[model samples]
Target: MAQKIIGMLGGMSWKSSAEYYRLVNEGVRDRLGGLHSAQCLMWSFDFDDIAVLQREDRWNDAADLMVEAAQRLERGGADFLIICTNTMHKAYDRLRAAVDLPLLHIADPTAERIKADGHKRVGLLGTAFTMEQDFYKGRLADLHGLDVIVPDATDRATVHRIIYDELVQGKVEAASRDAYRAVIGRLVAAGAEAIILGCTEIMLLVGPEDSPVPLYDTTGLHAAAAVELALG
Candidate 1:
């Protein structure tokens, strides 16, 4: 069987993008044994530029940028696309329309895993845009039949701050990890059966041990799904 090339639209932080690259390659090697690696292409962005657009709430501009990147991947002969950030999936519809390749949405595999685990209610932790917007959580609810919950406004702000101020910059302080553990506690109190580390960078901060319930890392799940499609 021939492997399909995975196109990664990344560099929303480059830190998490690096994880995606590692996880995808590791997945392929695990599936195919020694000396195997993923067939993949990547077009990374200057995250600073995207950050400015996100802060200004210029979603259309962000969408345009995403479309441009997806087109580049298509022209480079990518078989499918994976936008590496959960927040940027706000522009997913535009990217999907602009490109010929199938886009592997970050939320789909997360939702699927949550459902497969028999979890109907889950908590989400991500950038403010992903948490507060309709693009990600809405899709989980509307398309996947899962009930998604987010942190309160204050916790949401903390999650957003930690992502931009520390995680994205590759800073992983124990204080931030403790803060996230507290947040996860609250979500579990609120009847969340599982937690979705909705931001790719979040896997850097907390994991299953940090929570009483299950923790789903979108980067790992998304990359694993990409490998499946590439190898299947």
Candidate 2:
């Protein structure tokens, strides 16, 4: 098979975008070897526009912008599009509606892996949209038949703070990690066999060590799925 080209809709925050770029490229290199990393066509948005979308929760509007972006990628010769940020994926449907290119949805792979690993109930941590909306979780339940759990109001607030104020803003603090570990512990005590680090930024703050349950890093899962399609 010929090498595939993937496009990234990035810059929701550049931090996670950097991780996706590194992970997809590195995944490709490791598979094919000889410096044959992923062939990516990237279109990054400005922080200002992203911030506005985040603040207002204007998901459809935000996704429409990305639809244009993905269409441009299609024109630029990319075979598919990856929304580099988890929160931004809230508009995934809009982008899918707007484009003909195949978009490898991140939540499905995570859900499939969760089922394959024999996990029934999994706790989720992500931005407000993914946590509150039925889009990702509904897909997991309806499509994959996986049970998904999210943090309560209080824990969700703390997790959101840790992601937006600390991780996304680039303030990585040890204290932040401890706070998140406490959240993970609570989720596990509530019967979560595995914890889904649904936010890419959360993976940086809390790793598997912090979780009493298994940690499913959404960033890594998303990257691995991207590699599977891009390198097929």
The most accurate candidate by TM-score is 1
- Give me candidate 1's TM-score against the actual structure: 0.99
Candidate 2 local lDDT, 73-158, one digit each (tens)? 99999998888777777778888888888888888778878888999998888877778789877877888877788888988888
Off by over 4 Å in 2: none
Error of 2 at 145 (Å): 1.2
TM-score of 2: 0.95
Candidate 1 lDDT over 56-82, as tens digits, reads 989899889889988998999999999
TM-scores vs. true structure, each candidate: 0.99, 0.95
| lDDT for residue 50 in candidate 2, whole number 0-100 | 71
Error of 2 at 135 (Å): 1.6
The candidate maximizing lDDT is: 1
